[model samples]
Target: METNNVLKICPPEDSMKDCKTDIKCPIVNCDKVVFSSGSLRMHLTRSHGISESESDDALKRRIKVDPKVYKEYHCPRNDCLYNINSERHFTNMAGLKQHFLKVHAEKKFKCSKCDYGFGMEKDRKRHESHCGMKFTCTSCQCTYVSVEALRTHCNRTQHQIPEMYTK
Candidate 1:
């Protein structure tokens, strides 16, 4: 004496209105409101701005340099070309040496002065303090190397300096 639920038949779309797909982008809730699951993806790429998060600088054109400077670098990655423009940069042999030692599992560079190590000199320089002599203005966060430089910048600016800020 039990009755099967299948005997009590119901329409397939009896509550299908509430079952509509609400597909949206992974980012912010944009102005565009797409109803279909497939169309939502098309709207995001076509109408709204959406791009892959992957970083790629391979296709970019490298800066030109002198032949003497170009002779220095040996290309850090084995897959990439050995050619590189090393004009004003730090070292010539840095490319190949960096690849052989860094990406290919090379030893690290330890700083003698402190307990720190970096793959690049720029990283080391960034870690160093500014010697309490910043060029930019602390008040308005304006960038300039010296007080005289700041004054020159203020003079050229379209906005007038406030009376209270006069020094």
Candidate 2:
């Protein structure tokens, strides 16, 4: 007859403590430290507004696991509004890498009159306003820094666009 393992008595210990490991916040400049990966995930998702998959990837990068464990790629930018505003989940490393390259890595807005580029559209517009290039609407006598603004003014006033600006 075999003895059941349940019959053997074990020492009392904190099960939660046994499962806990020191994990730090992966976001740059964040000084928070949590005990378990699950707790860290919760912190990242709720406190930092990071997506679940992104937090999972962050956990994977910080923790050691089996070689056969699946890998997940996450956006490293903590201030990325795209990820925070919506639950953007990447299915593969390529998609995440592409998002970083296209969205975070490079400037998305450029000044039309200058070589300067900006990561935010508002920053680009502010810079363009002071870039020394001005477009004036002849009909309304209003000045704008960008041709797009002038075009908008023309549309609002029902003014015809100059032939030179038609293109």
Candidate 3:
């Protein structure tokens, strides 16, 4: 990324012009006529084609990302890499039943940020959210990953507060 790799990312200028080669955006659905930040308004107007009174959230939800969502399972059962797609298609019911029994039952916790360890990812998240232990933030006073993560955050960010006056 340091050196120019031929392509450069930018917004489109007009409908007649082609996108600059430097831009790496290959998301074909892009409604941009020309690559430029200013084309954002044009994109929303053309792509959504919504009424003026439409709420911003409603118009935005019209586009579905399920088509773009990453796959959840790969079914490592045999040589059958039969891609269990996200859109609800089944390759082998037996394979699916076996997989659920094997994988999901093995562990319970998961990291929200990354695919880290957990007895149960849900349990880990639950424990973090309401463990009842007080956590004083170092970066701010509120945001924290876990009580331990909060401690780490404070330690890393070096948060300090003034001492109250005493008699």
Clash tally, candidates in order = 2, 0, 17
lDDT of each: 0.40, 0.59, 0.40
lDDT of 1 by residue, 50-142 (tens): 423221121122223232222333333335343233222223223334333333331244444564664434334554433234455445768
TM-score of each: 0.21, 0.33, 0.20
Tell me the spans in candidate 1 whose CA falls farther than 4 Å from its real position: 1-72, 78-91, 94-117, 120-126, 131-139, 142-167
Highest lDDT against the true fold, candidate: 2
Kindly list the per-residue Cα lDDT of model 2 for residues 4-104, writing each as its tens digit.
Answer: 31122111223311333346899999988764566777678667777567546555456543434433334555565434233544644344544554465
TM-score of 1: 0.21
How do the residues 1-167 of candidate 3 rate in per-residue lDDT, one tens digit apiece? 22332222211223212212112223467634433322343345446563343443344555532333332333433333433322332333333433443343344345454544443334456665555555555347665544556655655667653122111
Tell me the lDDT of candidate 3. Answer: 0.40
Cα shift from native, residue 96, model 3 (Å)? 29
Candidate of highest TM-score: 2
Order the candidate numbers by lDDT, best to worst. 2, 1, 3
